[model samples]
Target: MAEDHPRLAEAQREHWQSTYGTHPGMYGAEPSDPAVHAAGVFRTAGATQVLELGAGHGRDALYFARRGFTVRATDFSPAGLEQLRAAARRQGVAARITTTEHDVRTPLPLPDASVDAVFAHMLLCMALSTAEIRSAVAEVRRVLRPGGTFVYTVRHTGDAHYGAGVAHGDDIYEHGGFAVHFFPRHLVDLLAEGWRLDEVHAFEEGALPRRLWRVTQTSPGGLGGS
Candidate 1:
């Protein structure tokens, strides 16, 4: 059905841009629960640099910087990235953070094995197709060093909104002008094919209490061994 609507990703990008423009810093200044957990994981893994995808408004990015990790945060929305940059400046962590306006459907801008850890909050469940999501994971694998950790959250099929909204096929549905691809368990297992899956923890967020799975995986090979 996504083939029937080829502009879905482009349209979703526009919607996110407009949404962030209308509601600047909508998610507030606090880092998400996943981000807080990820910081501990990264520190244990001896990670000094972090790459965050879909870093809206830089809440988590700023947190990583505050934790003493050099961070590069990327998002598709320029408006959101601008807000993130402003926050980073105000927080006096601008030197430790960098912002990029990027879409996950494209390859990551970094070179192979560049980052020690990667974090993505609710990014894999965006308006992207299953194939695109897989490709994004591959890119993450490419950019991470050996034994690097990748933590990401995705709204799963268990979510209340899974079947609600206009169907776009591939489990993608549009509701309240937001498009989401609710992931199935099989997809998550498939994405972790090559990597060592560390954990899959269920959690809820927002007033609607959106259901999500926080997945942690490590790249192939032991730390610095690959």
Candidate 2:
């Protein structure tokens, strides 16, 4: 289990850093559809600021910034963050975007109820354990303002590689030198505890048609902080 092995965790980080450093455009240059839809939803909700987790290469972060939202883009991989920073500068949205080195396993570096929206694309499934996912959700909730929006996507357990790789822990699998923690349907409930479950949709993307769940939830404004 990676949770039981410090070296395993470090290796996982190195793998991602290397992946980003080598390929650079691992996910491509275009912003994802879910991100665009989420930005519209946030706009509908009167949001002006967004906190994006695992903002690799800043496609979605730059998208949000270009759409007039102040975005805090975070990723644990320094190479990825640097790439995002460079993209933001080149896109002329550097003033609207802040790139940060952050790991979702730890507490967030923002204040409570500070952001109007939280967007995370396939980040929850990136080698995170169930406990870590719960902690990350808690942090997201804490950093969101009242009635804030939360939009995220994760690989569904029904994906083609669900059981193809070596088992790490729980639903986590190591395949092709990458670790992915596929999410079962029940995992959605873990994030819906203190928020309103607004949308849960089946989404597939990329050439492999990677199966995913696009979840959108909203934090209650008052008398709702459990």
Candidate 3:
């Protein structure tokens, strides 16, 4: 199934680059609702360092930084990362945040048990195969400190766009040059296997009002330990 979309990842990367280039800070400056909620969760967990995947233009990353959490934000699009860096500088949170060009399909460039909390808004549902998504979660597990918290959101099978657009198999569909892998509920449960699954809240975002699930989980290790 993964093989069917050999070029999907690269194509999506290019499309994102172009999109970000054309629409700087496209998502605007306000922090997302999930980010606001994740910030509280991280604070309650005693987290200081935050790792955010798919942090385009640093809206949530800057919010995390301003909230006193050190942030490392990564995205596959260099253009997006550049915009994030610029925004961080303008917000005077550049010292509190770092940007990296990364693809979630690859191993995260961080040591094991490093960050105290991780956040990803709509990152896990990007044009990735099932195996790739599992591997990405495993990488997240590896990089989280003992008992670290992870808050992420993904478009689910119930989303209106789930089956729309150009089908690329693996539940991934490309619409307006953006590819998304709409997740099934079983896949979410599968990814939460070794972790303490906390919550799966259903919500909507954007004018399309994309339906999504906000998942919160904790590492197997006890909270604030190690």
Using all chains and alpha carbons, the TM-scores for the candidates as numbered come to: 0.98, 0.95, 0.97
lDDT of 2 by residue, 106-131 (tens): 99999998889999999999888888
User: Least lDDT summed over 10 consecutive residues: which range in candidate 2?
Assistant: 1-10
Query: Which candidate has the highest lDDT of all?
Result: 1
Ranking by TM-score: 1, 3, 2
* Backbone collisions counted per model: 0, 0, 0
Q: Is candidate 2 or candidate 3 better by lDDT?
A: 3
lDDT of 3 by residue, 1-226 (tens): 5565768888888888999999999999999999999999999999999999999888999999999999999998899989989888898999999888998889999999889999999999998899989999999999999899999999999998888999999899988888999999999999999999999999999898899999999998765576
| Regions of model 1 farther than 4 Å from truth | none
lDDT of model 3, residue 107: 99
Off by over 4 Å in 2: 2-5, 222-226
Q: Cα lDDT of all candidates, in order? A: 0.94, 0.89, 0.93
Clashing pairs in 1: none
